[model samples]
Target: MKTIAGFITACSIACSALAPQASHADTLTIALDYDPADLYGTLSTNNPMFAMLESLYLDDPRTGQVEPYLALSHEMASPTEVMVTLREGVTFSNGEPMDAEAVVHSVTVFSNPEIVPAYGIYAPMIDSAEVIDDTTVKIVLSEPNPIVDLLLAQIIVVPPDYWEEVGGTEGFGQAPVGTGPFVLTDWVKDDRIVMDTNPDYWGDLPENIDEVVWRTVPEASSRAAGLRTGEYDLAMNLPAIDVDAINAEDGLTVYEGDVARIFSLVLSSLDIHETPVQDRLVRQAINYAIDKQTIIDALYFGKARLLNGQVVLPGQPGYDPEMTDYPFDPEKARELLAEAGYPDGIDVEFKCASNRYAQGLETCEAIAAMLGDVGINASLTLLESGEFIGQYVRRELAPIGLIGLGVPNDPSFGIGVYRSDWRYSYYQNPEMDALIDASRSETDPEARAEIIRQASQLLFDDAVIAYLFGAQSFFGHSDDLEGFATNVAQRFFVHTLSLAE
Candidate 1:
């Protein structure tokens, strides 16, 4: 593995395409660590893609409240039904009107399990969508979903006629037209994605920034360098170790916020993998082996919040104060390893994405070293973002893997990913599944919170994953930037950002 400075130097050749050029006065060149998998709002949830699309409701970054955007108002007609009224005269980038029919089409596309497979985990409760009138859309669910609004907030509208006319999901990725303030003018994968202000945008555009260019700069040091050298006005996911360096420099600002993401180590609980991770005590040992506090203090500078489980943060609903994390006890880890029949040692392959999270690879390296100290021979395999996610989606990850998981709105959303029925799940417990289902249908907020708390406890007791610290979200920008804010969901609202005179 290369040092951060060395990695940045190695990427210089690739970044030279845009790093050497001078950005326009009105254009904002934002640097991201990875290229988006897709821009169609399917199989992709990157920040840059979110800038090119807006949901029916937008979460206010300051308040964390769900506010209406395209939808003027919504009401629950029944336990399983929601009636929504659309904003009048709103049009997509392709000049198509955004009406009830268009909403139905977008919902249909997202609800289809075959068309967009990712939606099954995000919105499995939505059974059907229908148009009541030109401005009204009705949504029927398979069950009484308590967080339907949060699920619907993930859906970004696309022009129905233009979507089909271009082809389908694949075509829409190449040329996506949305109702967002920014229109995608060019997208060269793994290089850059260019967007211009939509003239027919229904919402207010950034007064100063006319064009937005997102350049893929994988190394964090490179992005920091780009921001410092005036090549980029803003950068996403800066390395925490360089925060003081960035803050100490003149004309630079860092916006720090708490995100709904957990960086944890997942061990395969399936029988398909004949490894020591299959044993319960071995998993427990793995949990006790790593020191999360050290990682948070040294790597994250105590900026990240610690997590007892991967489900929710301290301030979030359903968070259980009684639930506790495994202490960093290497002796206890060795005892558990010996009890699990790995008295001498057991070798485990750990796969992690280098560019997925802040200091991800460095953390993995530290974990591997700690595991070695506890008599477990752990080998670390660093992968690119695309390869890592592809393997993860296919459920072909190694015995041990490190990745970040976020329970954006509800605990059930994260629980659904671990159910045996879900394609992405590798672990399945009947009690866990029942709790998740019961909590989903629970109408009472307090009762639902209790059920979710029990589920979180069960997951923590089961040693489902080596719970790491909660990731702190951050954005790096030059002094000339203003009004830049990011939501708890880690979506960046580029339209609200403007140049400060």
Candidate 2:
């Protein structure tokens, strides 16, 4: 078996083959791993498409709180209703007013299951939206949602008039219209996406940046090489192994920050599938088998933090400091496997994306080796981003798979995956369902937090998944890049970015 060190050495060798390209003075070129499937923000939670779109609310970079962006102000009108006031003079790049009517249209389109398939499960929470006046709109919820503002932050506003004229999402996605600071100018499928500054943007225009291009570079070494060769201004998801080498360069720097995303091995314990992981003991054994700290230190260079629960991260709502992570106990794992009728060993197929997350493939390889120590033979099945997402969303990749979920601002956003009715759910528990359901309409902050805590406790005790660690994103960029900032949700502040003169 190849060691983690061997993997890093291989990556470093591969990085040296990238050729230099002519640099653009006014354009900030970025290297991304995968091409975006759609520019419609409502269809997916986190995507590169958000650079060309603006949401009503945004997370404050200083304080992880959701504040108004396009919408000037918002308040809860009733237990199940919210009133939002839009900022006047805001218009999409296509010259359409981003008023109350546009907000209502965005909410309506987002809440429709047939329109936004990926996030359709969340559509029922929003009952309807009504335009109170030209600047104010009222949104009715099916139930009292505690984190209404955080939920609203995910709805990227679009112009209704242009949407209808362009024939809905498919046509609009080809040429998206949003109120963001950047406008999409050209997109070559699976190659690059080019955007220019939105001159009619209502907010402050970007400084020094005339155009932004996102190139698809699937290899981490290639991305690092591009940054070093000046072919790219910024590289996303650079492996930790190349950080020291990149920083040693004169004009490059690597920035590291802890994000709200959690990576874990989601086991399919549903009764519809007959797998060893269905047994609670086997699941618990899997948790006790691997050492998360060692993986973090070896693969991430101590950049990532260990996760205690499945979804909730520290400083977020429902975070429990008292809860402990499963210790590395291969003996206990073996005993449990033996008790679960697998005396000699058990074979399981582990599926994971090749380059979805930073060091994703290498981490899975390490995990598979660790599982082997406990007499569990895990055959690794690696897939690319597109195939992995397709199978994951449809719940076709069963048994066990490594996946990441974003918590963003609240635990409510992350806990939805544990619900039985969730489209991507692989496990079921009636108690978990009840606790998650109760947290939705919880009005009082303390009460709602307690409910979330209880739900998290249920997931931990049940060993729903092999809880891993909170992810930290590493970006290799030119030292000349200034005011480059990203929120806890991992969204970039494109407007604030500028090049040093």
The candidate scoring highest on TM-score is 1
RMSD of each: 6.4, 8.3
CA lDDT of every candidate: 0.78, 0.80
lDDT of 1 by residue, 1-501 (tens): 223343223333322321223344588899988987777645547767666667777776756777787888789999889998899999887778999989999888887776663545756678899999999999898888777777767667778987776567765655567788877766677899887777788888887887889999998989989999999999889988888888889999887766577788777787777888988899899999999999989888888877866467666668788777899999999999999888998988999997977789899999999999998899988888888877776777768999786556566666677776665666778988888778778878889888878888888778878888888766799989988777776766887778865
Instruction: Report the error of model 1 at residue 218, Å.
Output: 0.8
Clashing pairs in 2: none
How far is 386's C-alpha from truth in model 2 (Å)?
A: 1.5
User: Candidate 2, residues 188-282: lDDT per residue as tens digits?
Assistant: 76788777777788888767787788899989989998999999999988888898889999999988756566889988889887989899899
Per-model TM-score versus the true fold: 0.92, 0.90
- As a whole number from 0 to 100, the lDDT of residue 37 in candidate 2 is 62
